[model samples]
Target: MEGTRRTTLVLLLLACLLFLSLLATANSQLRTDFYKDTCPNVESLVRSAVANKFQQTFATASGTLRLFFHDCFVRGCDASVLLFSPSGKAEKDHPDDLSLAGDAFDTVIKAKAAVDSDPNCRNKVSCADILALATRDVVALSGGPSYAVELGRRDGRISTIAGVQHSLPHPDFSLDKLNTMFTSHGLTQTDMVALSGAHTIGFSHCKAFSKRIYNFSPENPIDPTLDRSYAFQLRTMCPINVDPNIAVGMDPTSPRTFDNAYFKNLRQSKGLFISDQILFNDARSRATVDLFASNNAAFNEAFVAAITKLGRVGVKTGNEGEIRRNCAAIN
Candidate 1:
């Protein structure tokens, strides 16, 4: 009986190593053509669904974009953020993620349904891949650059409320803090700045940035770095004791477009988040922000590269994870 126990332990160790090796190999081989044969119309199916959602509400673009970022950062693009828990303890239930709009989850679910409606594609695609595709579609539909997304990701089974606490960047992070977090995921400072450009199309609730306008400091009522006029504007829009759920545009200049205007907003101290303003306030990252603000093409190129790299984080592939039948529940 002791020998049998020892053999079982050995088999478990071997299985773990094999799984790691397969993951490494599969992660490197995530290509755009991963489902060409299995689901030739996968991209189109996802695009159509995302487009329909986008037409219904422009929030669909920002919500889905933010959703993809949240999902990837927490569990490495495994769609773990989408998992629902009966105990009310999944990643989405975490305080940081609680703000994630339902529109984003609906976008992915809609796309998943569209994909599965096709007999050849039913159960053939992973929620992770569908999310990645839907994210790209939303960005393009909102007038951002269109890029090919790497696929072949499988849905992760683990989704714990505790897993999300330290995984995401906060609204008030400094440039140094931002760099430290993004760097851990193999993203450069430029990548961090570029990815942040997504704010051009998103909105942030008053709770996320009210500190800057009302009580930024004991000495100064408003954040010194904020444009005085913009601070007043924000104050008027988000008064004291305003509903925390009441939101404002993340990019004041071009609230609904995906463009370099976010960087431009940073230059004028109109960045809605302290983390956004720091890109220009700190000299080290100021050049990149200035460049992106001046050249839309450069921002688009860097954003695509950065987000493509972001998608590769902590990916589960090559049989390591399953193609979830429903994104909200682990199978």
Candidate 2:
């Protein structure tokens, strides 16, 4: 009888250990209320900071959104994109990120400051979490659906220009290239289409899309796929010798609002970037684009889902990274 009791006790101990292991794994992942106890006001503080910036300029919405995208694509959503290396070799210093607006970085800095204002929250919130919340706020403030952002992501310490160039999908990426890039991050083609909807609220520099408007090829001076009138407007806005710094809205119609119009523009061959228009050009993604163009609700739902998945990419947690004292520099 004593021998039987010893065996039963060992079994019970093993079961308890297994349960604790599972619990730890689950807790290590992101959660909706990770900061509820540590920084209860994190969400409100981020929202107010983003709102103040948005009130200053509507461009803040697109800027912050773009910042989040760049941050995630390079090294996950670790806020490494905000880091400033002494050698000027950080992710944001990459050629592709040169176009990332200053307003976006400023918005994050402001949001971080606001969060740290609370004594209980000072340096307690991770820049990564602040960025996620700011991104959600930007979308909601710009007439898009607001989704709950999962928290508990720690800040990454590494940011390299080479990583940005290798990881980010460029404006000139083909549909296949875009798919491959997104797929590497565990995002599906449908998610790529939905996330592309973010183009509805942003602007592009002439240098980024001028080839589409003029001298696309030796045989076809202009891209034949581009709409005639739309091409003409782009040509005017981005003349062959025009200053590269000049910018044009990605969505000419209601560019300030975040909506499904980007997909609609893709259907009409009015997409501003080759990457944006290629969704409709490819057979695999075209149907998804059409569906989103026709249904705003569906597009918004997919976008929320995709962005949430994006926030989970390469997350740092459970002693994996630090909560930096300053977002732009590592402690």
Candidate 3:
């Protein structure tokens, strides 16, 4: 009888140890209110700063959103994309990132300044956190869901031009390529489709999608998959060998709004980038695209969940990284 009791006690102890281990593993490195005490007004300050920028130019919404995507996808939500290397070789210097709007960087910098203006919060906040908050504000201000963001990420000290190529998905990425790239970061196919919905509020350069409209191939000129009228409109906006710098809204109907219009555009063969259009063309992801196109509420919910997951990618907690005094330079 005593031996039986001893065995039961051992099993109980093992179960407790297992529970504790699982609990620790499940504990996120970040918390929604991490700055509750450190910088009580951090969220409000960022929101105000972002609002001010939006008043000047609605483009700030797209710019900030793109900046967040670039920052998170490369080097895991750290502000490495913001680093300005003196050698003219940095992550942001890469051709893929050349289209990142200056207003986005400016918005983040302005928010950082607002946080620092508070005596107690001066130099106490992480630029990564500021970027995240500003991104959330940009979406909210643009009439999208205002989801709570988890904080406590530290700014990475390293930013290499070479990293950008491997990290960011190109404008011409097919569904398979996008799956591979996003899956590397622990995101699933659903996450990839939902995140792509961010195109609802951004613009693409003429060069980025020129192939879809012109000289797709010798056999198939002007990508037969594109709608006829839509193709004609794009050709008018972006002439062959035209200045690559000319830009057009990704969602021509509602370029500045954050809604399911992007998915709707995809359904109509009006997606600006090949990467965006392929979500609807690919059988593996087409159902998701269709669902989002039909339901704005569903799209918003999925996007918020996916972006929240994105915010946690390879975060640096504890002492792994520093809080940069200047977002563009290492502290």
Residue 245's lDDT within candidate 2 is 80
Candidate 1: which pairs clash? none
lDDT, candidate 1, equals 0.93
Instruction: Tell me how far the alpha carbon of residue 63 in candidate 2 is from the true structure, in angstroms, after superposition.
Output: 1.1
- Give the runs in model 2 whose Cα sits over 4 Å from its true position: 1-28
Model 1 spans > 4 angstroms off: 1-24
Query: Per-residue lDDT for 10-67 in model 2, tens only?
Result: 9999998996675456345899999889899899999999999999998899988999
lDDT string for model 1 (177-279, tens) is 9999998887999999999999999899998998999999999899999999999999999999898889888988788788899999899999888999999
- Off by more than 4 A, model 3: 1-27
lDDT of each: 0.93, 0.90, 0.89
Model 1, position 124: C-alpha lDDT score? 94
Q: What TM-score does candidate 1 get on C-alpha atoms?
A: 0.93
C-alpha lDDT (0 to 100) for residue 147 of candidate 2: 93
lDDT by residue for model 3 (237-276), tens: 9889788778888887888889999999888888888888
Q: How close to the true structure is residue 109 of candidate 3, measured as C-alpha lDDT?
A: 94
Clashes of 1: 0
> lDDT: which candidate is best?
1
